[model samples]
Target chain A: MHLLSIRDLVVKFRTHDGTVHAVNGVSFDLDEGETLGLVGESGCGKSVTNLAVMRLLPKPAGHIEGGEVVFQGQDLLRLDESEMRDLRGKEIAMIFQDPMTSLNPVLTIEEQMVETIRAHRRVSKSQARARSLELLTMVGIPKPETRLRNYPHQFSGGMRQRVMIAIALALEPKLLIADEPTTALDVTIQAQVLDLLQRLAADLGTAVILITHDLGVVAGMTSRLNVMYAGFVVESASTPDLFARPRHPYTVGLLHSMPRLDAQPGEPLIPIEGVPPDLRRAPVGCPFAPRCAWRLESCWTGMPSLEPIDQTAQIVTTGPNVTHRVACWNPATPDEAVAARPLREGFTPAAAPAEAVA
Target chain B: MSGVTGQPAPGAAVGVASTGTEPGRPLLEITDLRMYFPISSGILISRHVGDVRAVDGVTLAIQKGETVGLVGESGCGKSTVGRTILRLYRPTSGRIVIDGQDITWAEGSTLRAMRRRMQMIFQDPYASLNPRMTAAGIVSEPLEIHGVGSSSERRERVRDLLATVGLDPDYGDRYPHEFSGGQRQRIGVARALALHPDLIVADEPISALDVSIQAQIINLMERLQGEFGLTYLFIAHDLSVVRHISDRIAVMYLGRLVETATSRELYDRPIHPYTVALLSAVPIPDPAIERKRRRIILTGDVPSPSDPPPGCHFHTRCWLRARLGNPERCVVEAPALRELASGHAVACHFAEEVDGSPEQVLQVTGEGMGGSSSRRADDSPTGRVAAAGPGLAT
Candidate 1:
């Protein structure tokens, strides 16, 4: 059974001019103990999708227009505020992108952790403090006892991120939503943080939904991946299957554009042209049509439903279940002969019209 | 001038002859550059002194039309070196020669003119670009300050600059807040190009943007460089980004240059222990290689700059030092940056003798610095020293 499932989720923000459809008809599922990565560019609605699941979207300005967020056989969207609050810290916890903003500046680390523990459970102050120290040590922070008294400002960026992780793990929540947790960290620190997250998730049997703009990070850490375009999930598949055979043009572009550490210097990086479409006005068809290299005419006129490329064939023949699914009308065939064709390159901007896909 | 004769002060021109061949002269020469800010106590701040040596004794030369990358972790002072070159902050000591002109002491109009030839692209586009100013006004402000052209010409040039950076010319009338992060950064690039600068200092320009947008900006910069014959001083914490754009790469740590070499040389075979550790830490995309790849996890936080280590800035955490037996000299004397190969330079006491292979370095430091004490005896000089390796001072 799926641990969390999102179906046709639509989130919108009411602005001065009009409502902005930040997350439009996005859908995905995470199995028990599975790591799912949500990849997209800025303003692509990846963060909004996760926020919708957490029911943390700002009210008055933002609301979920339509969706069903099913978690452990219960619909989270149907839950009342008080019921959701009870489950929030104990069953589901989220680690935001910026640790500095997420943490309270005035409170000591011990005070913050104890409050979180006390809010969710009836525990003594000393017991709560001891549990907090254990969480801190589990996340790899040095000298947990000494660090408990320190304020957020005293810790370095990396340590602060580790503290955020510790707070997220306080209740041993079944699921964790980490939104670009290591984006601001240095590479070395980033590696350590990722390693810690992977190990803890496996040991504790906690599911994680990792939201990021970096394809390399997604490729490295995620078990399953979702490629998001303007407010929609363009592709979804297992990590190895996605990397081995990407179907959506947007996913292909993303994979090709990243400059990996293993790649030799001076090789030309293939960046997708143009920017993500404005979310204020939902597009009639594929949002990535303007930037996709292999976009067809149908992509601009009508939206494509998420469907299996071939119903008869399984996504991964070796896996226990077929999980790969893409929302592209003309998905690329995963064959060595077809993949061997040279990618189209060097098309001048002047020769091509701005809005035209081909 | 009191203590030194041949060496020049900060921003003064070094008198070293440029080999006289002059095919491509060094556009900027920085020698023994230092920028120190004092940490004080009490209300009146009346103490003897303690200083944070942000940029201490960094020597480098950027040739005309050559892109050089200054790479390091945060707090390493790469940004300070860039700011010092542009004279945004007054340096405490050392020399900065720009276009063969000594602008170290130049003030008022002279300094303003020097600023025209060198411009900076800041890291945070949202914070850097003034929200109050329109795109056109932001780009043309430099021209207006320098009095380079008339109002009409400046407007026309701003349009051209916008086009050059792959932004719509019509968007110039809009405010910075009206655009996305990538568009605002394009405007930042357009503003940087307004002066037709000889050299540009890009300080983590794409680190704030999305990865896909980062690729676009990097590609745009490369295209602009080829078209305008401009040189770039790219400063970033990511080695992959630096390797993609730089001809030569320099690694800095706690305000000092630890290694310098060609992009391929440094990435393929990093000589400095710190550089090796840093490279091993970056997560590669390929799952097979990533699993097999050796990772170096250095222990302990970076020491405060106000009280850096006594000798080498990196000695406290140097993987090579621990592997080759922690020499006493590493704690007493600092090693000078010397040429190991034709163009590669590394500043480590056992640069040549150390087994700098990624696997060896990772094996030594992977468990963190706690294992250093045990390996100290096995790697000591008395144990076994290679005969033909680089000579050790201790």
Candidate 2:
């Protein structure tokens, strides 16, 4: 059974200029103890989707306009403020992008962690402090006893992020939402943090919603992947399946655009042509139509709903279960019929060489 | 200037060589460059004592139309070196020669003219671009300041430049806030290109953008360099991105260059312990390889730049130093940046031989020998003479 299910979710921001449709009819599910990677560029609403689920969107600016966020058979949207608050830290916790900003600067690490622990639990002060130290040590912060007295500013960026993770995991929430957790960190620190998250989630059996713009990180850490474009999940599939046979033009473009370490030196990096669509005005058709290299005329007139491509039938029917989906009318396949069809009128398939297979 | 093809012809416009005394010289040469900001105490009366020696004695040579990548963790002074070359921050002392001109001491109009030839592309696209101004206005400001042309001519130039950088000319009137991160970065690139600069210092130009967008900017930069014969000092902390674009890569540690070599050389056979650890840490996209790779987890946080370690700046956390029995000499004296092989320079006391193998050469020279017992015992007069090659001391 799905651990968390989001169906036809729509989110809007009430900006001064107008109402912005940040997320439009987006639907996906996270299985129990599974890692779902949400990949998208800025303004693509990957973060907004996570925020809506966490009910952490700012008032008067953001609100869930439509859809069901069913977490373990409970409708989060139906929950009152107090009811949602109880569920937030106890059941579903979130780790924001920047750890420094997320942490309380004035409070000691111990004080902050203890406060979090005591906030949701009926525990004595000493018990809370003891638990805080345990959490600190669990996250791999060195000299936990002495370090607990130090303030947030005393820790490094990586350590501070770990502290945030420690606090988030204090309750061992069923679902952990991490929004670009390692974007600001160095590579080494990023590797450590990612490894820590993966290990912790496995040990705790916690499902993770990892939102990021990095495809490499997603490929490394995630079991399931959702590629978002213009506030909608353009494609969704198992990590390996998506990478192996991406059907959507946007997904293909993203894969091509990445500067792979394995790529030949001086090989031209294929960049998507244009920017993401403006959210203030809802897109008439496909949001990525402007930049799609293999865009069809129909793409500009009407948006395509998520549909399983025919080529994925083999994997989709497998025992482990593969639910590969793409929101594109003209899905590419490695067969003669699809390959023979022109990407664009008067556009030859041979014109754009498939440089790297992988 | 129409259809100029932007590529500087081989040996074209040799107006003035930076090192005129030495024939066939590099276009820009920075030798023993240092920029130190003192940490002072008291408000009423500040006292000078300690210093954050950012960009401490860096030496590099950029040939015409070549892109050199300066990369390191944040606070390693890669950005400082780029800014210092542009005189954004005046170097404490060093020689900066550009086309035979000693720009290190150039002032007033001379410096302003020099500035026209050397421009910078800032990292933060949102912060760098003026929100109030139109994209056209931002791109044309440099042209107007330099008195490149009349109003109409500048407008045409701006349009052409916009087209050159893959932006729509009609969108020139649009504010920076209206553009996406990648588009705004294109505008930044167009502004940098406004002066027709020979050298561009791109300081983490694409770091703010998304991964997909990063490739767009990098590819655009590569294309622009080919079309315009531009020399780039690409400053970035992302090793992978740097490797993708750089002809040569320089690794900085605590404001000093610890390793410098060709991108291929650095990636395949990194000599510096820091470089090795850094390379090892980069997550390979392949899950199979990623799972198999062992990450060299460096212990402890980067030491405060204000109170950098005494001997070797990286000695406190040097993985190789610890493996090499933590020699007392490493704590007493700093290692010289010496060229171990062709185009590969490393700064390490024991950088000579890898794992104590006889095939690896370990030789100390000059003042380096006088300070260390290990070096004195290991060094011969013949070895000292051989190691004292060109640009060895600096």
Candidate 3:
């Protein structure tokens, strides 16, 4: 059974310049202990979807027009503020990218952490401090006992993020939502933090919704990934399967466009043409059709719904199956997937090779 | 070498094939470039405590029409090197020779003339472009500052530049806020190309854009380079993107050049321990490779530039040092950047020994060296002497 299932989530922002459909009919499911990655570009509504799930969207500007976020058999959208507050830290915890801003500058780390622990449970003050210390140590912070009294400013950027992870895992929430958690960090620090988060989540069997723009981070960490483009999951599949055989044109375009370190020298990058559509006017047929290379004539008239591409070949697994699902008018077949390989010698119409600068 | 059609041998001198022309030589050459910002204390009687050595002794040469990538972490001063080379900040000490002219200490109109030859594209397109100015005004401001042409000619040029960067000419009347991040960057590009610069220091031009948009900008830059025959010093933290766009990649750490080699040689066979760790830290996009590969996670954050470590700046977090039983030489002496294989240079005490043994480095790290005494004792002196080869040590 799914731990959290989002169905037909439609979200809009009531801005001064007309209504912006941030998320239109978005749906996905997450099982316990499974890591789900929402991979997309900026303003693709991946973060908005997670925000709607947490009921953390900023005031009257944002609204969930329709949809159901069923979490542990409860519709989060219908829950009251008081009841939702109770479920937030204790049931579902969140960590954001900028730990500096997410954490309080004035409050001591100990006070903030202890407050979180005591809010969920009727624990004594001293007991809460001890628990906070243990949690900090669990996330690999040295000298947690003394570090507790210090403010967030005393810690380095990486250590402060570790503190954020500690606080999120303080109550042992069932689901952990990390939105671009290490985007601000250096590559070395980023690797360390990602390792720590993955290890802690695995040990505790916590479901993780890892949102990031980096396909590399998603490939290494996530078991299942949902590629979002223009506020919709263009493709969803197991990490390995998606890398091996991407069906959606958008997914193919993304994988091809990202210059790979492993690619041969001077390999041409096949960039997708045009920019993301303006959200003020909703897409008539397909949002990605304007940028997609494999758009069919019918794609100009109707939007394609998410449908399984090869259901018969899917194998039953402990978590979600590797069944490829893509929302594309003309998705790539398994054989045609190889055609999406990085350019070797010559350039195609999509990939214009610049003469080597030297 | 004669039989090979398109392949240049690894580490072949990059600019030997160019025909002698006005700007055909190395466009920008720097020798021991350093830029240090002062750290002051006490408001009433502010006294200089120390200096943040942002760009410490960086020496590099960018050939005309070649893109040289400068990559490092955030506080590592890759951006400082670009800014200093552009004369935005006067270097603490070093020489900057651009297009056969020494503009390092040029005064008055000479400096102004030099600025016209070299332009900069900043990382944040949103902040870089003035929000109040129209796209036409933004692109044409440089032309006006240099007094390149008449007002009507500049207006026509602005529209042409906008079209050259893949933006609609009609959109030139719109303000910066009216445009997207990618469009604003195109405007910045058009501005940089306005004066026909010989060298363009693009400081993380695509870092702010989305992944899809990043590709668009990269392709656009590449196209512009082809059409204009431009030279670039691309500074960025993303190693993969840097490698993709650059002909030669230089890895920096703690404001010093750690390694420099051709793009293929650098990625395929990185010698420096810092370079190896950095390359390993980058997670590949393929899950099968990512899971199977061994990663070397550096232990701690980068040290403060104001108070960097004594000897080798990377020694404190060096996995190789610990694996080699905490080499005393690494702790006592700073290694100079020396050529290991042809044009591939590294600043490490054991670059030769560590070649082709990255997996061993990982295994040693995984074994929990703990500064153990059981390492091969004989490996130390040979590494020291080999790295301290003829003319390597200052």
Maximum-DockQ candidate: 3
Deviation of model 1 at B188, angstroms: 2.3
Candidate 2 recovers a fraction of native contacts equal to 0.48
lDDT of 2 at A7: 92
Q: After superposition, how far is residue B175 of candidate 1 from its true place, in Å?
A: 3.1
Q: Taking the tens digit of each residue's C-alpha lDDT, what string does model 3 give over B1-394?
A: 1222222221233322322335556778999999999999997999999999998899999998899999999999999999999899988999999877898898878998778778999999999999999999999898778776678777877888898898999999999999989999999999998876778999999989888888889999999888777889999999889999999999999999999999877876677888877877787798876776556678878999999897889999988787778989997898999988888999998776565243354465558632111122122222223344442222
Candidate 2 per-residue lDDT, tens place, B1-394, comes to: 2222232222243312321334467778999999999888989999997889888889999988889999999889899999899988878999898877889988888999889789999999999999999999999898778776668778887888898898989999999998989999999999998877888999999989876688789988998888778889999988878888999999999988999999866765567777766765666554444433444556566787788888888888766676567888878887889998899999888775432211122221121211111111123221223344332222
Which stretches in model 1 have alpha-carbon errors above 4 Å? A314-321, A333-358, B1-24, B45-48, B353-355, B365-394
| Candidate 1 Cα lDDT to native | 0.79
Candidate 3: deviation at residue B145, Å?
A: 0.9
Q: State the lDDT of candidate 3 residue by residue for A124-216, as single tens digits.
A: 999999999899989888889899999999999999999999999999999999999999999988988998888889999999999999999
Per-prediction TM-score to the true structure, in the order listed = 0.89, 0.88, 0.90
In candidate 3, which residue ranges exceed 4 Å CA deviation? A311-320, A340-358, B1-25, B356-358, B369-394
Using Cα atoms, each model's DockQ against the true complex is: 0.43, 0.29, 0.47
TM-score of chain A of each: 0.91, 0.92, 0.92
lDDT of 1 by residue, A121-223 (tens): 9999999999999999898888899999999999998899999989998998999999999988887678777878887888888999999987767766787
Q: Candidate 1, which CAPRI tier? A: acceptable
Residue pairs with clashing backbones, model 2: B6-B227, B17-B100, B18-B99, B18-B100
